[model samples]
Target chain A: MDRVTGHGADRSSGRRPVLTAARVAGLVGAAAYAGLLASTRPFTVEADVVTAVALVAAASAVVVRLAGDRSVPDGIGWRPYLPWLVMAAAVVAWELACFFGGARPSHPTLSSIYDIVARSEAAKAAVVLAWVGLGWALVRT
Target chain B: MTWRSVTFVVWTVLGLATLVVVALAMAGRGRIARPSALLFPVSTHPVVRVLVVLGWMWVGWHFFAR
Candidate 1:
């Protein structure tokens, strides 16, 4: 009798898959976020945005892998860090938009954005989608 | 019950559900095995991999970095 593994691989050969650090990190992050969602206050706009992004990122990753496109690059060198740079840029842009654009308070922190978006369902949904898309991109490359 | 109380109850349930799922994944048992198996590929993807890192960073940034 042969034991079948989740990836459709045969495990009867007696070789167990080794869990890598990256995989551990992903699992821990997902678990932590889910925990946060459950233990936090009424869903703040910022929390919602982050949740939406995580779901979208997870979904997109599933789709891409299922598509069977092996041509995707392996993120050589500094490519992996690009998303951090993008996030930093987004933070700066948020600050500038809040200050100069006058659409929000002088300091546009997560709390400020949450206060503004929490009240409006449409605004909240839109911001969630936009942030999720950015987050998806952040993960993609 | 007030909305806050209702939310608290709801979240408590959700938190339990999340804990169960995490536990299953950690143990690699039951129906979650397949999905847990897929996590390796998903995490390894160049793009998705970055999100994992960023997600952890986001947690720190939001909760501690202020």
Candidate 2:
């Protein structure tokens, strides 16, 4: 059954359907990240890994769900996910490189050298949580 | 009681009280799709609503933990 709104399309009125759970979830995720762009807070290295899990979960909801939309925002299916996934990867790598490069020069506790290592490990754990959450979203009563 | 003891008890009661109030508020709403009622039926939502409210609590805790 279509998960968006339980009721399928009505044949008579023919209005465009509302967003599905996946689509709305995806849209909301994108919007949330888009909002993050305006944040003035200094970016820390841990953010990348945390966002990776969040990014995947959000993107997956949009891509997999979006109900019948082959594409949205004028981009065809799966296209929108590419940039986010790539950006997340690049951020992770960037953080790692920065951490390794700065480890020698920075304060032991204040710098991101420690953050990079911590983030990567934490990101792994977050991925597990995302998986569980996604599965719960799927199986939720 | 020590300040630590009092503090713990107060916060615990506050947390549980919050939960109870939310539950009561939810119950007062006849059902989802009923905006006529004062209380919004949050439990009927697709789990995300509950999670979102809990997320707000988490944010509150995260910010207030210090």
Candidate 3:
């Protein structure tokens, strides 16, 4: 017996069947932007400029989503999401504790660890690309 | 272990826990809610969806910008 569960019943999986020309072009453009941002030094004006561009992209996703159907969804229940809420709360709590306790080398915040890992140009570019990709996903969702 | 080491360990554990949840969800485990299930309804609310993306923006700035 086949059981069809979850949303989008017509679709077997959420993934796109084929990458369109527009998507390929977008990926190429994002990669170029990531490389350009990777070359900039952190804490410099150049890095700030790159960050601003990324933020704008994220903001654009918000605009695009809002421009669509504005109807309130049915049954936005908290029960199903309790586990995720708890996990998010735990992470936030620990981050706050570490932050207030002093972000020493031994007691590093997540961002502090990210800073160390993102020091490499390749890693930095990858992170920027990931952030851009996440924004793109947000737009699509 | 020192308090600092403990802090680092706790953070690592939290990160790992998140990864585990994502992996389980992706594997289509019946016990776990998929990422789409967790986030799709979030996009339904106009205000909440905007706030979520704004939070994402803040994280990028915090890590990558001055």
Better of 1 and 3 by lDDT: 3
Tens-place lDDT per residue, model 3, A1-141, is: 012113334455666757899888999999999999888887899989988987887787678768876676665556545657778999988878777876467677777878887889899899889888877766566
**What's model 3's overall lDDT?**
0.74
The residue ranges of model 3 lying beyond 4 angstroms of the native Cα positions read A1-16, B27-31
DockQ of each: 0.06, 0.02, 0.50
Best by TM-score: 3
Q: Tell me the fnat of candidate 2.
A: 0.00
Give the alpha carbon lDDT tens digit for every residue of A36-121 in model 2: 42221224444444444444554455344434333223212333233333444654554454445444333222133323432454
Evaluation by TM-score, superior candidate among 1 and 2: 1
> Which model is ahead, 1 or 2, in terms of lDDT?
1
Report the error of model 3 at residue B37, Å: 3.1
Q: Please give each candidate's TM-score.
A: 0.31, 0.25, 0.83
Candidate 2 DockQ vs. native: 0.02
- Candidate 1, superposed: residue stretches over 4 Å from native: A1-141, B20-30, B34-39
